[model samples]
Target: MKKIVIVLVLIGLSVISAISLLKTGEVRPTRVSELKSQFLEKATARVDHSKFPILQIKAASPRDLTAACLSCHNKTAQEVMQSNHWNWERPEYIAGRGIVYLGKKNVLNNFCIGVDGNEGTCARCHIGFGMRSARTFSYTDSTNIDCLVCHDNTETYAKAPEKGGAPEPVLDLNYIAGRVGSPKRSNCGVCHFYGGGGNNVKHGDLEEALFEPTRDIDIHMAVDGVNLSCIDCHTTERHVISGKMYSLSSMNRNRSHCESCHGEAPHADNILNKHMLKVACQTCHIPIYAKAHATKTHWDWSTAGRLRDGKPYEINDADGNHIYLSTKGSFQWGKNLKPDYIWFNGTAGHYLLGDVIADTSRPILLNTLNGSYHDPDAKIVPVKTHNARQPYDPAHRMLIKAKLYAEEKGQGALWVDFDWHKAAEKGMQALGLPFSGEIAFIRTQMHWRINHMVSGKDQAVACTECHTRADGRLANLTDFYLPGRDRNLLVETAGISLLWISLAGVLLHGSIRIAASRRNSKRG
Candidate 1:
């Protein structure tokens, strides 16, 4: 009986230890507080949301929860209403199509194509409620704002896919509303990380692995490292968060930058610091991306219609990332991918709707990053260039947006019916644009800028990696003269000749000095 009681006490102690470990996973505990509590304590609001009488009621709809939030913070809704997250379009000066509003609404990308016809599914990412088609969706309605999606601390708040951006049915709105606070990593990542359907598919740098990254994966966001959150760098003002991917944002204004926090002279080395003049910080710091998971590098939408036995099938790679899907297409995923370096100014140009494809033979750059060595603002940056083979119209000589997802599937959705012609016609019809009856495939590329998962300073790019003659990083960039890689034969020969001449002079002078010293010693 005594032995049994001692064993039971040991089991209880073991259970408590396991629970403590579960709370603090790999995160290093601090002297004052655990890592999780450190972030929460920093985000402590003036008033406890639990004390509010209005939040106690069980809301019938998510809209009711938004109304309750607006009772006190009414101005926030108006600010979010005008922001790009709500509108998804901004007035931008595309080179040929000057000052036209361009965004996900009209811009044609290589991944999922345009979102004009598939607004219901695409609205999953939009921070709003009850967004249907482009014509029916109310842009002026401030009440459509989803305050809990961003503010909910419970992290239970999630948008149901294909439901016009409605909250999941099981989520207790009352419980979630009472725990509202500033947005956390999980809040922004729910949409951003899951873009292009799955994890790390859209942006190669961003993935689910960043949620609780190791020190080697990301020095900033690592629980053991600096322990920074997304909002720490992307500071918000009124509802507009800083930072813009050149993918959506065209204008250079309101951009978040590393230099904003870490000065231009972040490096202690003079040479490395000087490199900042022409090289962006990300080029060296984030040497490789998709560190923990594979990202979609090449997507072939032409091979999407293949089925196993009347039913669509899917195939995954060794890493469990989808390689082939009957709905999407054959995909080539890459992990620890070295980025394609490009010179980029803050400004960029994008391929808008109705733009005729001039040269269909060569792969089209869906969005062109405007820069060169000559441009003062231009800096060499690492970019993940996602290549794709997608559907386009031969007659119209343009990329066609195929109707993908519907609230109710199999109406004209490409994934449901697998009819390219019908889907193209339906998609173009919704956009009020002419579609050619003929369908063809064209090769295209989209460059996504890598700015996250920054490795430690010690793991930065070595000098020889970019400077060496063989497999040099700057091989594609030939416009400017790089001292190590770029030099004329005459200069090389002259440098060698001068070097030999200096060595001979030193040798002769030393010999003469030695002989004089011997003669002086003999005379003494």
Candidate 2:
């Protein structure tokens, strides 16, 4: 009888616990796990080029190897020929300037200016061989495609400096051609990481350190982390890569987004995921850039021509970084720095060569990053603002292009003769633009979107970092109201008044209840 009574009590207790759980809501939504990276599942080994008898022949030149690749991938070579890497030209529409052909061939940058007269040196980054001059370059040449440069598995091939994109003479063409495969990080880094003449010169986030990085530096590229390759994110179809730099491309198309891999709603909390509406993934994830090396933050071309003795000289800081040079100018380098916040909707406009500058008093925004807090499509993104004191045509109100590279001495190249007027005239004449003759130094700024050197969630920015009134990352964004940072005088007074009224009402209700309870007790 005692055992029966104990069992009945336990059943009653279980029923009460179940009822309590149901009332409190027992079901919870589970966050799905992130899918594996698609590139990680791809086959690594395919098409042994060494087995092909055509690749065994001793190649006399880089073009001979291209012919062998064409024998199998004739269709692939055609696709490559159409790519921007080969032609260095893309038809794009700008905001004010409509339907302009913007590319490295004609687009102007603060560093090195443009590639019109400097094709011999600048064409080293081009995929095809023999692009000595834009006017003289034959885009129809099929054999000009340097197949071994991108496909070289032996890592023995490289484009020689100032050789019109030809492979280095020291490379064993036959050996590299036999072992051809898809491009690795080193192949892309060879030109990209070292662009603007040295390591970490152009893009701050991309550098030599990305070859093999730790998890702290870049969670995506880290060997111990996901160990992702450039091709993984770049995701090429035929030869057209998906990602395009706004520095060259002006369109909103063909961009790589973080959502490509991680879903739009990756966070567990709804509050955190809602931030994806206005805040870009990079804004919160990439707190700093140039993780391992210092990037050039400033360049003063006004101080470039100063020479030591009769010869051009270079100066390095205690950290062995170029601080000043007779050819380039004075530079300011920064390492692991925070990026400037900006509202970007992907569309951008550039001050193309020969385009007149609107204002002379303020710094010329060489490329204007257009967006506002009101735009629904726009999101806050982090960018590296590269500032420079570049040469300008004050009379024409335009940024001037100077002849930077010279094949021989006394060719009016600024690097060789140190004559700004002669270089400007020569460069302008080559591009079919009139030179103003009056050259003046003017401050200019260019924005490079920071996408790489990403950090994981643990290293991501905290809420207080951008929520505080002072030293906030998004403090410069004053157009919209940010909670915890922004406070209005009217709202503060209304909130305080409401709080005092609620407190007085609570006290009055308590006193009335106590008085009623006392009256009831006296009547009893």
Candidate 3:
């Protein structure tokens, strides 16, 4: 009876130990479950914007809706007015140029030249109202703010390009006002995706397709994936959005990088994690850009004004891309394009207005990525190289802003008359600058940093792509020496010669040792 009791006690202890071990080893929830829980927590905490009194009434204009919004959120207008989106200007210090004000308002681009004389059309992208012209526009007016542009969740709010930043009259302001909430991908895509007057023209990475992306399109923004919105990464504070483009920014502005969400070390491999020091996350993640549509890679304004049968004509390439448009110019479109690699530390050297040109013969670099292999903060980043041949003043040595559109008939617009001289003269007059009267086309290049269109891990660039070839993605990069791809003939010859000599010495020594051993054995 004592042995039986002892055995039973031992078994009971074993059972208790096993149960404790099992409890300790059991995984409560997986990563998927944790993500689901987090999503549920957020879903339960959502607020209904319809309950607000300001959004209850019907409004005529976007400004009126904004006035209603300001009644409650009075500081919101002041916060937005201070943002780059409203001001269209940001002060920054350049390398050669000292502290200067730069933005779309001042910076000259190949597309639409500059916003100096075209504020009305360009103001469609602006966050303000009644920006018909630079002279008449008031930046201090808080009532000019458009709150529905970023906050509307109804998806019905839209600003007409020709309406001087006003919302369409047909839209139900009350319905849209009631549905105002967090900004969606579609909200941001309205202007950004259609920049340069068309879809996928300005920023190659951003497109309308991102509104409802699939897992294969973009892993982060995909509906089937994390389904992250633009605001998730572009975390805004005081109505100022983060992530300024290098071309637009001069100073080292605050930006939301991959490290903001993904830690410094996100890879499983230590080797790959170490690579993050010199390799940008987008360099490998976005293997190709313009996945959804073919983006314009080249534009030649010199080729414009070509007419067939006294009417403007257009030519299409083999891939059905617009090669020539009578109104704009010849274009080169590309899809699934490999990015041009560059060393970047977030700083960009922009060609500000009145800046001296380095080379007049070759394509002038509008903006160049600022970094080197020696820079510890620099990394190899991918960029979209947009080439263009646009109008420039030969005498003033500055890019010319041609007046392309006008509300009236005799406004000296280039599209109206097909005369470059008149358009240049009118544009310069509007800007209050003297025209040299000498019009010439010069090749120019702009490097657009690629940051979106993230692919799956399996679609990343292979190791051999850059390691084995001289003309690889990193071919232009000469900051560091690659082993297999870059080799010195003298060093290779010396290494080969030393290897041969060492092999010969070893063979002779082994042969002599073998013969001596056989001789010793025979003597024994």
Using TM-score, give the best candidate's number.
2
Cα displacement (angstroms), candidate 1, residue 235, comes to 1.1
Please provide the root mean square deviation of candidate 2 (C-alpha atoms, Å).
6.2
Model 1 segments more than 4 A misplaced: 1-41, 493-524
Residue 466, model 1: Cα distance from true site in angstroms: 0.8
Predicted candidate 1 versus true structure: per-residue lDDT over 1-524, tens digit per residue: 99999999999999999998997676653332443465544555877887799998778888888888889996877888878888888788766667988777778888898777787888888888988875578988777888888888887889897877888999988988888888888898888887898999989888999888898889888878667889888989998889888888787788889887677786657789899999999999998999998999999999987888888999987889898999999999999999899999988888777779999999988889989999999999999999999988889898888898765656788888877888888888887778978889999999999999897678888898888776788789999988778779898899999999999999999999999999999997
**lDDT of every model, 2 decimals:** 0.86, 0.86, 0.83
Q: Is candidate 2 or candidate 3 better by lDDT?
A: 2
For candidate 2, list the clashing residue pairs, or say none: none
- Kindly list the per-residue Cα lDDT of model 3 for residues 104-150, writing each as its tens digit: 88888777678877776788888877888866789898989888888
TM-score of each: 0.86, 0.89, 0.87
Error of 2 at 469 (Å): 0.8
Off by over 4 Å in 2: 1-42, 493-524
lDDT by residue for model 2 over 1-524, one digit each (tens)?
99999999999999999998996685554332234444445466677777789988887778888888899886887899889988888999887778988898888877777888888998888898998997688888899888776777776788899999987888888877777777887888887788778898988988999888899989878888667888888889988888988888888888888888777987866788999999999999999999899999999998887777868899999989999988888999999899999999888899888888888888888777778889988999999999999998888887888898898889999889878889888888887877779999999889999999999789998999999989799989889999989999898999999999999999999999999999999998
TM-score of 2: 0.89
Q: Which of 1 and 3 is ahead in lDDT?
A: 1
Candidate 1 residue 409 C-alpha distance from true site, Å:
5.3
